[model samples]
Target: MKKGTSPALEVIVATHKMYVMPDDSLYQPLLVGSDFFLNQQKGVTLPKNLILDNTGAHISSKNHNYSELTGLYWLWQNTVKKDTNPDSFYGLVHYRRFLSAKNKKTPLTKTELQNLINLKYEIILPKKRNYYIENLYSHYAHTLHIGPLARTREIIKEKYPNFLPEFDRLKTRRSAHMFNIFIFKKPLFEEYCEFLFGILFALESSLTKEELTRYDGFHARFFGRISELLLDVFLYTKFPDLDKRSDVLELQVLELEPVNWIEKISNFLLAKFFGKKYKKSC
Candidate 1:
């Protein structure tokens, strides 16, 4: 892959606010992830590719609910530049949650990204995340309305039967790979996005807004939250002993520290104790 011709690894930094970051040697395509209507309204400026995320379900009006995955949808549904770079690996990292260097805090450089690929790593992920004293299901139930968590199970059983056992198995685990963040080879990226969105879209249609809204503002981005848990399920399905076989997660996962710790911690605690019942009005 010649650098002048096309990038080998292209990551879409999903951001929705009015901000700017100039493109550099590393391939960062700024994706404005929101519905077409809101995209026109946000007035954000990116160096390249500020995509209107409405191309899929026109769900940008509900962007508060889908969160960053909405931007990912735009990359999946639109993004012609990927066609020009057929072998380019794709990744979605937030403006806040970049894949950091092992010893330093900066976005992984072109050389680091290429080395991972050269090593035959299948994916790049943040490090193993743990929520002590809570099985995956119990923690989710305490935080979000567990109904949708349950519904996801039924959807898999009814629609994607093959995945049901792993789904069931994953529900019992205490830790997970989270954030809707990942890097994949073009082919695996395609497989992952297709499998992920297919479940989210179908599971959501079975739900009403009443059923979906758990945290008035935050949980509304329910699909993204739910998908975070499923990533572990997806991985375990592929590599049943993944945790044991590779604490490094296939040498495929590149670990990083997430940004915005204050808000992130607050949300986790609030969700844990309150679920949808955290009411200031009370």
Candidate 2:
């Protein structure tokens, strides 16, 4: 593929509970957000792009905790077999969030996205989310589960010992790739999903029933959170020069509109004070 030449890019927007309309700019709009096993949600309209992710041991009903990862799993189990386009790419974005174009505000429209895909970049990632004041450990400790973080490290050490160094180093850093969203070619996407689910499943099996049940909705999404950090670890391992500006492998970084600071702060506070009451009501 030549620079400035467009390619077929298929991005899967993993929306768990929400059924937002798809943007017209992207090549293929594959929505992976169906509720699995049962119909718990009342009024979600399955758009034409819907990928029913409820089957095959899905965690669709637990979207509050698992986030968009449930949709990713659906793609892994069912969608991969049908892909045949050599120029095709696979990506995951959120219904609420997307990888903005150069404007740093809006999601990439068809033309803008075509120009990007033309470059045939190895990876397309959201801008690195930095925690300038404190490193990754302190930031995660303040907002998310400290136990799962520790357990995840141990799991990496025990199962993927070679990745332990990257895992350890990643946690100490001040910033990392957040949101677990990205665009990768077919090969990289498959490899990533395989590795990611491997670690998550192992951790799940390692937990006792009591220990597992202890994590309410607030913390049950441990795997999803850990996967955010692992994205960096995975890139660093594959492309050692990933952080540096180099021509060998181009990693396109994009920014989106600012996140809802007010809502985030409110949720954090509620998690601290109300405890798992948030889960109870939901």
Candidate 3:
């Protein structure tokens, strides 16, 4: 708990490129596709502060398909679970999206994290993103290929039947804690990884080579996007009273980059009304 010693909360910022990071010990910048980057660009130098996902028991080669999830996998396999401190908290944030404190400009600091812990918060998440016009299923089906998500539901029904109800409930909901972001105390972190990765791995095996390759570049990263929905399934199934739980906290997401709302809305409308799929990131 001492500031000069090990941090109480360690949040890794997943990034594929170099960028300015918060000047706080709590935030660690991670190079998501380090192996691929190094192999493709032999002469380029990487920042020392950015930890490579390729190191020690990692699925670094899958970064292209898994996206930032490779970083999460590396952390799960090689970092947090190995920590000596049982009470330590761990989390993942993107280089551009972070969980903001009350003022909305600052990233959640260790002091604030400690305060949450003191108040009995075992997990912290971003506020749910609402698609007022569409439920989560229709929203995803509108913007992206729904095949993988539908396949995921089948996997849940077969392998985790208890979760099937909540998974189906997603069709009726318009909001979700998305983007695969979260902070959790050690135990919950491990439990989440086990449940999440188990489903993803099964889904991965179920895909045909053709199914995986049929999508264009943006849609190929289905694993990461699909996991975003699974977070809610895991939380809601395990803790049905999640909203009332003193152990869970939801915070605002701070977008470090300016969002192009006009283009984003246009794309959403096109996808929802015109049956067009997204071709690029917004």
Candidate no. 1 TM-score:
0.78
lDDT of each: 0.66, 0.65, 0.89
Q: Write the per-residue lDDT of candidate 1 for residues 1-282, one digit (tens) a residue.
A: 123445456777776664454254554544444554454676644444454555544456556767788777766655523455546677787665667557655677778777776766656777767778678887777766677778889998998888888888755777777767777766667777788889988998998766766457655666777888888777778767766653233212332333456765676677677564322211
Please estimate how well model 3 matches the true structure, expressed as its whole-model Cα lDDT.
0.89
Rank order (by TM-score, best first): 3, 2, 1
Error of 3 at 7 (Å): 7.3
Error of 3 at 39 (Å): 2.4
TM-score per candidate, in order?
0.78, 0.79, 0.95
Candidate 2 TM-score to native: 0.79
What is candidate 2's lDDT per residue for 17-119, written digit by digit as tens?
A: 4445455746334434354423555665555555566766566654544567877776666555356555666678876667766535556565665666666
lDDT of 1: 0.66
Worst 10 residues of 2 by lDDT: 247-256
Model 3 earns a TM-score of 0.95
* Pairs with backbone N, CA or C atoms under 3 Å apart (clashes), candidate 2: 36-54
